[model samples]
Target chain A: MKTIFFTGKGGVGKSTLSAAAAWQLAESGKRVLAISFDPAHNLGDIFGRTLGHKVTRFSANLDLRETDLDEAAAEYIRRNTSILTEVYSYTKAFNLDRYFKVLRHSPGVEEYAALTALEDLLRTSDDYDVVVIDTPPTGLTLRILALPRISITWVDRLRRIRRDILDKRHTVHSITGTFSEEGQKLAYEEKDDRVMQKLTELFDRYVAVARHLESDANRVAVVFNPDYLSLRESQRILDGLSDLNLGVNVAFNNKYTQGLSEIADSMERELFDGRDAPPPVHRIPWEPYRREKSYEISYDLTQLFAL
Target chain B: MSEHQPNFLIRLWRSLRAFLRGIDQAQRERVVALTAYEARELENMFVLMLLGSFAGMPSPPSFLAVELLPHLEHEIRVLNRRAESSTDALAEIMGTIDADA
Candidate 1:
């Protein structure tokens, strides 16, 4: 199975390409899932159908879904909040609820939820041969990408801290019934594991899913529009994604062209199709029907999506 | 946790710290999209994934049942409710593509 993670700065037509690719793949007898992890979901518009949380039938073998992070973070929080009960009270003592209200706005929190969704989808959704993800805007998308590594480091540190704190005991057995130093150690030990436990889960999922992308066979594609700044941003992201050791395939969606005909020609020759030059580019050119954002229901999108 | 790498707990602690620093302009700003300046964070994410490293593995992730479905249900509910309020169902259907993102 291959995972095509189409991520870049938002509004560069990531969903448009992912939906079209899944449509194309499904038409060719491969089971396909066009999943959107963007906070602002837009696949419904491109595919002429609403993409809900659960996989909805878009075609004979194609399904669509948009991941929700708010609920993911809440679930992760529900299990891990116990470890932070002491600190929760401490935070409340300092009026941290005001901040919790605001931390909801953090880029990291949303990305965590998105990554959790990605991990689950990649692992559990075995029905599909291909899972095409339409990612969020660049900044948050990058955060989600780095989350696996940062999370692993965090969990490792937590385990080490727990071990260090446990190793510093002066006396194992205590005389007091309720006030024993041993009792305190036991309490902290459990609390520490509680914290480390979730961290470990997060780290594991991130690493496994990330490695799957590193393979050339997985064919992780970076989708982009033909704008200069967006193309530049895509190059930078390509360099960054390369650093992540994830196998990447590049697609320049020459979707819209008002005045840059020659540039598109050059891009197709040198970057996308490479008819005359290099061959890394797997160009999914823009279809004439997709020029208008508003779409009519097509009986068969396979013909519609033909490059 | 130790004074080392940032995890959910550490980020939470930092969140609290930011909260305490004041409910001012700085606190209001949480995410600065590194996508614009540099790709350090993005590279880091892939590096971790590439390593196939992790300690805790839950039997199955809690995300599938809880977050993904519930959020979709909510969105659908909201959208349906909005649709019901409209007298011209045809117009709503025609215009919803542009209305809801």
Candidate 2:
């Protein structure tokens, strides 16, 4: 799928830009899914409807969803716990609630939750010609963008360890009678062992996501206000994406008004610092009166289509 | 004793069966011992990965660890024993007797 991610500092007009792009893509008869990972979602307000965690049809050929992180997190935990409970019923004595509490505070919970949601979309996105993601502000956006690569490595190591353990267990089990207690427990059938199976599934899922994001079909557009702070944040985002080998094309200078163009010219110059200027800068016109009608407001954002 | 004596063929067949059964029993015992040895090593390795956090090695994500915790109770017990013992850590896990310890 052709994926375009819109991100910037708070109030950089990313959601608006993403909505516009989704609308334009749909108008051109391409199936489009525009999703908001921003906690403070304005996509719903733009579409003038409350979007839940599920995909909501915005118009013909267009769909939108604002991911509810808490809902997503709970669902992620519930799904994992159920699978774990089934595979390792013996964990019942370990005060699982305490461990789950630890998971709640785990450093990368939000990132993993977001990644889980993204992987779900990618797996099912064959129906869409393009998927446009409206991400959270600078810091969280960068973290979420980097999540797949980090997670893949983490899971890969776990898989190797699990495989070795299983291999040993298999050798032991074949020698022991299958009816023996330890033999039964050590049964390491790759097809039957759900714990190992889960690891393998996660490993494959993470790898697929990492590869997809790194592929040329995926592009990131950093939305920034013409202000120095937004520009600086965009630079960090650019560097972060480059580190992941993700493509960043077209920085959108949004909410243009009152000689902001002049500010953008100097800011862009300072930001790029003689490196090949990051993607061409696209100037979006200021439309205060039509602010409520974000879809219409963003229709003029056709420059993104060229990207 | 002469009245109870079996045919020569039948007596020979019974003697061969008993001898083969003895050999099968010995082979089965050896296989079971070898398997038990390998199984212990695998079980220890699995425990190390899942509960590595307890040993100060970074574990898989806490959520994953939590999920695997139930299946790892036995491993955890073994780990606890190993931790409490003054025995060499490597020897304890590999199921080899430490002569010095």
Candidate 3:
């Protein structure tokens, strides 16, 4: 399945643009799942429905979800804590439960949770032809985008450390003819080491996430208004994605007006500099009167995102 | 002569063999302890890398570290003990020497 991410500064019409894109894709008879990862969720509001963490069917071909980032973070910690408890039942004496309770409030947990949620959606989205993500503001969205690659480096070092520890244990075991101490059986080989196995599993997961983010199946689009702050933030978003060796597939100049054409052209020049073939820039004209339904405005923008 | 007693040369030979075996066993135990200590030191380094953020050092992300917590029972136990006895200077010195050895 192809994955598309819509990100920009707050109140830059990301939810509207991504919602429109999803509606357009679904209208074209393609199965689509549009998810909102913003903590301040408005995708459901735009759709005129109350959506939650659960997937809701907005139409015959479209599914909608607004991820609860707080709940996602909590669930991520709880799931890993349960796994730790299950594997090391004897660690109760160390008060790991209390320690994990503190982990819920730890830094970067939200970003990690967001990454995992995206990973899950991507992994299980085979039934859908396209998945569009409405992400949080620039900072959090950039961190989430960069997480997979950053995490892969740490996981790689951890795997090496685990291997060294296993090698030392093997040496000790060979000399002592014993691998158990204080009723705990230590693994001296890579295959038998649970820590090594966990590290390898995490390494593979990080690698998969990194590959998915950098692959052709993924597309990123930046949504912004033709204003100074929005243009600057959009440039930052472009630079951030470039730092991660990823490119934007499109740019949505939302609320475009004739007066702001000069500013918009400058933004395009700055954001797409040094590129031989820059992605197309689609401008959504300003509406004189607000429409009762989002589809009314989205109808024209559909062809811009045609598959 | 007592019925339990052996001849003088046989008794001397048996005593000598027993003495050598005692020294050999002691050397074997020392080697075992040293290897075990080295292995433990390596394990400590591994745990430190994972949990270094708590020590004001850069470390792996907590989500990843927490997943390996199950297999870190021994390291955690050692950390708890170290924390409890951290103020003991003599013990710390002895530990340093033991680690160095």
The RMSD of every model to the true structure, in order and in angstroms, is: 22.9, 4.5, 4.3
Candidate 3: pairs in clash: none
User: Candidate 3, DockQ to 2 decimals?
Assistant: 0.49
Runs in model 1 lying further than 4 Å from the true structure? A9-11, A69-102, A169-192, A256-262, A265-279, A283-285, A290-307, B1-101
Where does candidate 2 stray beyond 4 Å? A82-102, A173-183, A274-277, A289-291, A298-300, A303-307, B1-45, B67-74, B86-101
Q: lDDT of each model, Cα atoms only? A: 0.54, 0.73, 0.81
A1-307: candidate 1 lDDT, tens digit per residue: 6677777667766666667667767777989888887777788777667667777886788888877667776666554443344335576777764554443444355666677777788788787787777877776777677667666565565445434433321112121112122223232243443333544555577678667656543655566666666677776666666566553555545355556666656654433342222224443445555444432323233432222
For residues A57-94, write the lDDT of model 2, one tens digit per residue: 98889998889877788777777667656655566777
List TM-scores for all candidates, in order.
0.58, 0.81, 0.85
The predicted structure with the larger lDDT, 1 or 3, is 3
DockQ of each model against the real complex?
A: 0.01, 0.31, 0.49
Candidate 3 displacement at residue A56 in angstroms: 1.3
Candidate 3 lDDT, A41-134, residue by residue in tens: 8888888889998899999999999999999999988888787667766668877656657888989999999988988887888999999999
Q: Where is model 3 more than 4 Å wrong at Cα? A: A80-99, A275-277, A288-291, A298-307, B1-31, B80-101
Q: Residue B11 of model 3: what lDDT?
A: 89
Colliding pairs, model 1:
A145-B45, A146-B45
Q: Which run of 10 residues does model 3 chain A get worst, by summed lDDT?
A: A298-307
Best by DockQ: 3
